[model samples]
Target: MSMTLALRRSIQTTPEQTATVFHGRRQSFCRFGDRVARLASALRTQGMGSGDRVGMLGVNSDRWLEVMMGVWWGGGVLNPVNTRWSGPEIVYSLDDSDTGILLVDDHFLHQVEGIRTTARRPPLLIHVGEQAVPEGMLSLEALMAASAPMDDAHRAGSDLACILYTGGTTGFPKGVMHSHGTLWAIGIQRLAQTPMPGGSVALHVAPLFHMGGMGRALVQFIAGETHVLLSSFDAREVMQTIERERVSDLLLVPTMLQALITHPEFDCFDLSSLRRMVYGTSPIAEAVLERALDLLPHVAFTHSYGLTELGSATTNPPHNHGAQGRASGLSRSAGRANAGLAVKVVNGDGVELPRGEVGELVVAGPNLMLGYWNKPQETAQALRGGWLYTGDGAHMDGDGYVFIVDRLKDMIVSGGENVYSAEVENVIARHPGVMSCAVIGVPHPQWGEAVHAVVVRKPGAALEAPDLHAHCKAFIAGYKCPKSIEFREALPLSAAGKVLKRELRAPHWAGQSRQVG
Candidate 1:
């Protein structure tokens, strides 16, 4: 179940299928597979081996897919660098992963141009952009052109496929090691659940480095569907692409959905080609989701739940949100485990608690990543008894729906009381003046950690702390209300659209061993 085999199969099954569309060029599956094979052979000549890590930092493009497939075909591991990170932050991941070959698009070349002074510099550079390789970097086009296409390595099981770096407790990103078996299983399962026959166009508007975008693209690719690539999300461009390409499926975050639904020209666009609207990464405020549902009546909404540790689209059963009895279960739940995945909610002592008890959700399944790369201790702690202990606190109801309460760390401990930040954030988002908000734990001399909120207001709205406090007080307990508030033009967000509460709470924990709970 190597991704290489999947690519080869797509080419054989439907050679003429549009494998990728980026910057107005469409490449067929057969041509895409041949490029991948030649690139793999070229990378092999350049010293990438079975488990060697190859770092990629680039804007999304056809080349990203080509190089990623090339890495796998070369029997190497991919280490996808986050597009939004400081130079030191980027360097830290390269050092931690010991990546030898660093690939970069032109937009990010300036970031690594002077990284050689560091002890952990990548040995080689592959330029993945249009313009000529700037002076010293190896030309990506030349490498593929010089090499001959190679055959399958035939690794159809749990071999390390890619290392996706995600933010960790160490205050830097941890590399998540996903296997070929796991990645392929999740992709095939998604295609089985939502069959994308040959002509179906899958839009990759989400960043490819993240799990959701990667999963969505793979699912469509395995079925020989057209790939509509978007470098970065633009709400207007998303709708325009749908109309132009006759896109069938789109993976979106709640933030993107809000922007699209509220776009002034949304009503004017021909969006009927869209059949599925899958959302996750973060919870959507109820009103925003409801409004989106009302606006796009023809599309089926599938709420996905999973992180990089467990591949995205973990649980996406077809559901009708308006159905009276089903709505109560599905709306508040993150659906049941998708095929090849198993989920359980466990207590602090690691005992599997009975249904309806709010415990830390743990997943034991094929979709779970192999482990955290280069962090054996952290990996062992996370992968206990074959289950990945997701920090997310959740409870499974009788019908097996997972209700995510909050992250065990994000659950506020205030004066001996447990307050979930997601609970407070949900309430704060209800305020008309609030465009977005993140609840974080701050220094409290008496209570240990006090609830603090950073808010981004709606454009042209007059908002005051007192008014916001009163608003939250109406919906949730006063203890969970923000004791301090900071107004920002925009909140810090990860590629997946998750609010970085850790970054927001950094100042408060400067001199102490920070407690997440």
Candidate 2:
């Protein structure tokens, strides 16, 4: 079934149930459904047609969820702009996808002017700000109030649903296309693995733009549970919100969890309502996990492993967690293949490797994405012979558990966010003072891994770390900028003259059990 129809069930069966709670502003399913319908009607009036792209650039809120369903209900494709991306990067996605309409919250409204100037086709803007509507934009609240609720477009299964952009190897971003069926399958499969609590209060602290947050939201919606949302992740606010809302289920990255559990006031809050915590985006450190387990003994921690191309591929179930499971080394595994999906570690030639041998992890199932949008060659290369070649080096145990050894792709995940070294290198290479650069993820105490850059300065150039860091931030998101930088005379290079990132990463990662953090 399609996401639109799935949402309809909640509205029809539990219309009076609390659908969304954002900073104490709660809305019933009936009201939420009406707003979604009216928003859909308004989108259609603004020239959104079947499969037209509608970009949403905002923080996590009830309105964000409303716009997501509203876009699909109006028979449009969703393009959730990365909240961390700079204006130019955001503009590139809008232009690349040919988006005609955009939804912006008060937090990101400042970037609209820059996006409008750079984009090929300036989008029709809808301001979702808490304050009054800004100049040169339509107010989302006004549009919903003025428009009449319309019938659903009945778009389901195989219909173009979302175009989620991911960092590319060639300095640009690639849009990963997913159908309604793909997303729905992912949510349903996850539910099969670990069911949500009855009348669960699911908290939404992760950015709604990311697949992790949106995917979790999808599952919560299907279960017809209440969604408590915060605009963004703040350690203090998260603890406070959990106490006030009595949040039962939570989706967070390891970094966010670290921040929350380590906060000085963490123990002061009555977080007894928390029953489930789903974490992913990067591997959590053993120490961090142990500390979390000790602090919240009642909460079941589940680790998920997946990519934008394949949603919810593997999940380390809660039973394999805690002190007992950690001692057995079961906590290191990425878990067995998810429900109804086939996962195998295969060699470069596409042959399945032995269970204990590390190889490229490939996944095949209905949950896989359609492909990279408009990039046929890249799509074909990624989806070879019906298997999605996940660029992750992994091995399966006799028990069917998968353990990721290294990243086949030069990617780094820091603070629970994917940071492509190539993308960062591209920005660094542009600096006039930089002769050469190699970016890698290094072991970090707090963030799990920090973006570390090794740069070779030009002859007679006196470049500092702060200089390069600021330069990168001017183009990409701040999180992508190198947290630590080293000026090297020259980087380790292979016989082919390629920078040997593995050698660069070795000293920092020595003694670590897994190559990845």
Candidate 3:
């Protein structure tokens, strides 16, 4: 079934149940479904036809969900603009994808003039906020209220669903194309792994533009769960919302989770109502994970590992977490493959590697993306032999647990010896003074490249390179340890909480032609 039918089923099963919660406003499934249907009719009358791209640029809100459902219900494709991107990046995506209808809230309406001027063909603007509409934009509420409800387009199975742009941490973002069936299968797969609780209330704090957040929303919607959305990530708001709304299921990246547990007022909020917590984007810091486990003992912590092209590859379940499971090292893994997906580690030649061998991770599944939008060469290079070649460097254990090492491009080759940055970062993270750390290769005169580290010290804690060197030597070879260390108050992180190592390496190789050894 298509994503649209999933929402239809939810309304049929529980029409009067709470469907969305934003601020103090709430909507039931029956009302929400009618709005979605009306939204489809509204857009169809406004020139959005089958397969047309409709873009949304806003933070997480109930309106965002309406726009998502409305687009699919109208048989239109979604182009979720990254809220963190600059004007030019946004323009490039809209131009490249040929998006014709754009929706924005009060927060992003200010950028409309810039987008209108930069894009090759300006999109029809639809303002979704409660404030008065801008001069050139139509009001979403007006359209929904005036239009009549229409039937679902029933677009399913291989129909284009979304065009999500990558984080562009390394370079320009590529449009990853996902089909209705692909997204549907992903949501179903997540439910197959763990069933949703009856009348569950889910909290959405992550940005809807990212796959991690949108993927979670999709699964929750399919499971017929009530959604409680926040405008943005605020540690205090997250805590208060959980206590106020009795939110049962929530998704956060590891960094966000760490921030939440470490918030100054964390202990004041009664967050005992939380039942499940999902985290991804990057591997969890051992110290952070332990602290989270101690603070939220009743919450089930799950780790998901996947990319924009591949949906829901692996999930570390709650049973493999906590103090006992952490000792078993299973908590550090990316978990085994989910049902209906095949995951493997393969060498450069595309041969599958034996267990415990570090190699490029590959996934073969129906949930894989159709291809990159308008970039056939890049698409062919990424998708080969019926497998999506994920650039992650990982090794699987005898029990089939995947342990990510580093990005294949991020592996540091110092003096001809390859060093996985994640390996070094893990050791540094164990230091009592360290809050977070990222390792990258910087140009070296003699060694060609040297292992360098950028670290953030915990509040009121002091750490030195020599002490860090001693710690690393205890666990790994001296060659793998950082040759030089730089301390930073903070490091650049993507919206998904992943450390932007490419940003860290850019300055060091600014004048150099070669990047790798």
Candidate 4:
């Protein structure tokens, strides 16, 4: 069933059920569905039809969800614009997708004019903001008020659902094409991994634009759960929302979890209502995991592993975490593939590797994207033999739990020895004063590419490079210890919280195709 059908079912079964709570704004499923239908009708009335692309440029808001549903309802594809991207980057994605209508929130309205100057321009602009409607853009609220709820066209599962752009990479962003069936499989896989009762309240902390954002958000619709929304993740604010709304579940990346654990008021809030935490999109420090277990021992933690293309497919269920079986280190392991999916690591030859041996991780699944948008050659390159070449490197244990080693591109070869950045970064994160760390290969005349660590230290903490160097040396091979350490105020992260290694390594890789030999 389409996502819109799911919501309509929820409205019929539990009309009074709260659909979302966005920064003090709350709406029931009935109300939310009505708005979705009206907005869908509005887009349809504006000449949008099946297979067309609808663009939404906004931060987290109730309107964002409504607009997305409208696009899907009208049989158009939803293209959620990344708020962090620059104009040129945004223009490329918009133009590449051929987005004909743009639904924008206030903060990004300034980008609308630039969007118009692209080769082809959107025909209609609906400004979504609390502020008065700007001169040229149409008021989204006004349009919603003017339209009638649309009749559900009930699009097929094979129909296109969304176009997610990731740059949130090294090169120019590519639009990952995901379909309704892909999303449906994702929703079911995620729901089975974390069993939430009907009354569950989930926090919307991640950006709604990224894959992880909507992937988790779909869980709410599937379970008919209440979504407690936060416009952005501020540690204290999120803690307070959990206290106030009794948010039952939410997902956070390792960096975000660290910030929350370190927040001054972390202990001040009554967060016992929180029951489940789904974390991924990057590895979490072992220290941070220990800290979370200490603070909220009752909270079941789950780790999901997948990319935008796979619709966030793999999951390590709640049963595998903690002191129970973590003695096997399975708790920290990335986990097994989700239902309806296959994961295996392969060598440079694209041949599968033996179990427990690390190689490039590839996945084949119903959740995998049809292809990259409008890039057939790239599509053929990625989806070879029905398997999506993940470009990520990982290995599976004897028990079948998958452990992500590192990105294939980020793997460093020095003295003919393979070095995974995650291995070094994971060790560096053990440092008490280190908030987060990303390891990248930097050009070295002798070794070719030497291990370099870019670390973010805890606030007001004194941590010297030599101190960290000594720490890593104690646990890992001295060679794996960062040959050089660089400190940053904050590690640059994509919308999903994965460290942008391309951005991190850009300085050193500028003159070359990439740093490693």
TM-score of 2: 0.98
Per-candidate local distance difference test: 0.79, 0.90, 0.85, 0.79
RMSD of 4: 11.2
Which is superior by lDDT, 2 or 4?
2
Q: What is the lDDT of candidate 4?
A: 0.79
Expressed as tens digits, the lDDT of each residue in 197-217 for candidate 2 is 688999999888888989989
- Backbone clash total, candidate 3: 0
Q: How close is candidate 4 to the true structure, as a TM-score?
A: 0.80
Q: Once model 4 is optimally superposed onto the true structure by TM-score, how far is the C-alpha of residue 457 displaced, in angstroms?
A: 30
Give the local distance difference test score of model 2. 0.90
Per-residue lDDT for 1-517 in model 4, tens only?
Answer: 5777778789899999899898788899999999988888888887788899988989888888888888888889999987766666677788889888888888887887877775366447878889989878888788778998888767758888999986323334678888888888888888876778867998987888877879888988888888877788799999999999988898886567878888888889999999999887654556677888778888998888767777665777777776776776777677787777788888988999999898988888777888888778878878999899978778888877787755675566543234567667777887889999898887664455678899899998899999998887665555567888899898888999888888987898666423111
- The 10 consecutive residues of candidate 1 with the worst lDDT sum are 411-420
For candidate 3, lDDT tens digit of each residue in 218-246? 99889888999999888999999999999
- Report the lDDT of model 2 for residue 106: 91
**Clash count per candidate:** 1, 0, 0, 0
Off by over 4 Å in 3: 167-170, 410-517
lDDT for position 352 in model 4 = 92
TM-scores for the candidates: 0.80, 0.98, 0.81, 0.80
Clash pairs of candidate 1?
1-156
Model 1 ranges off by over 4 Å:
313-316, 325-329, 410-517
Residue 237, model 1, lDDT: 93
The alpha-carbon lDDT assigned to residue 119 of candidate 4 equals 39
TM-score: the better of candidates 1 and 2: 2
